[model samples]
Target: MRTVGNDLVRHQLHENRKWYLLLGALLIIFGVVLLASLGMATLSVVFLFGILMMVGGVLHIVAAFKIFDGGYRWLWAIFGVLYLIAGYYAFTAPVQTAVVLTSLLAIALIIGGIIRIINAFMFKPLPGWGWTLFSGLLTLLTGILIIASPTSPFWVLGMFLGIDILFQGINYLTLAAAIRNIPPSSADV
Candidate 1:
């Protein structure tokens, strides 16, 4: 009446259970630390983002010269220069960078939410369209709230980061538990 598939996958997951547990524990610890030092952690995250942008810019510049042959190389170079300047400013003034980035994030969320809402309506014939619409509405509300309280970026960014980390840790833990609980058939290794 029913079929079971991929015994080897089950065995592998069982074998790797310890690693999953370890990862979950590590994430939970990091989440706790993030929550404890919310402001400092937020600042650190912003600075790290700046560093990543610089690295991305460098890579883009390199790719423009080495990877691309003709058309968009100059455009890539210009983008690289802009990224470098933005990264330098972010590193030099992390607090200000965080504020500016927060505003950008708000704008992005609003635009993305609007797009999602429109797409949901376009795809109304598909299953789970309501969920998509709900998610878009939630995103829209969150963006609006963030924009309304423009001055609370410091706390908002910090608290959201910590909460996200905590949820990630919980997700890992749940995944490990689910893997452990999976029933193996006779074909299992």
Candidate 2:
């Protein structure tokens, strides 16, 4: 019962399975390394974030000039300046930046979790509502834990990032295996 699209997908997946395997292995290795050195990972992320913010700030400033006729040109310039200032602070005081970022992350997670929990209830008639509810609950709990834990600012972001990467690697590996096993199309016969 395979359609043409399915056959095409199978062919493409089989052809690219090696790449997926390589990417998954690399990600898994990175995740493990990050987890092993949470402090270094956190600092590394902060430094990278700082650099990105600086780049974004510069872009925004350039964009402000590009859109000189726009009514909100001043606003854009202001935001760009603000971003530059923030980026400078991030570079100068990464530890403080991490704390602020982690706090923001916790707040966001809390808000998102609440929204998801509410949505889950609204979608209770759907087939997998329980999973949504569970995920929301987990997110809410993690946020709370981050806020409550005194040491969270130092390691939470790194730990969560590492775990996410590890899981992503696992997902890619699983996908690679599945793709590798895709049945050959009739044309292959």
Identify the candidate with maximal lDDT.
2
What TM-score quantifies how close candidate 2 is to the native fold? 0.83
Clashes of each: 0, 0
Report the CA-based lDDT of candidate 2 relative to the real structure. Answer: 0.88
Q: In order, what lDDT does every prediction score?
A: 0.83, 0.88
Write model 1 residue lDDT over 32-114, tens digit each, in one string. 89889878777877887889889988988998898877779988988888888888998899889888877877888899899
Best by TM-score: 2
Clashes of 1: 0
Tens-place lDDT digits, model 2, residues 1-189? 558878777777877889999999999999999999888788877887888888888888888889675767877888888888888988999999999999999999899899999999999999999999999999999899999998888898788788888999999999998876678765554
lDDT of 1: 0.83
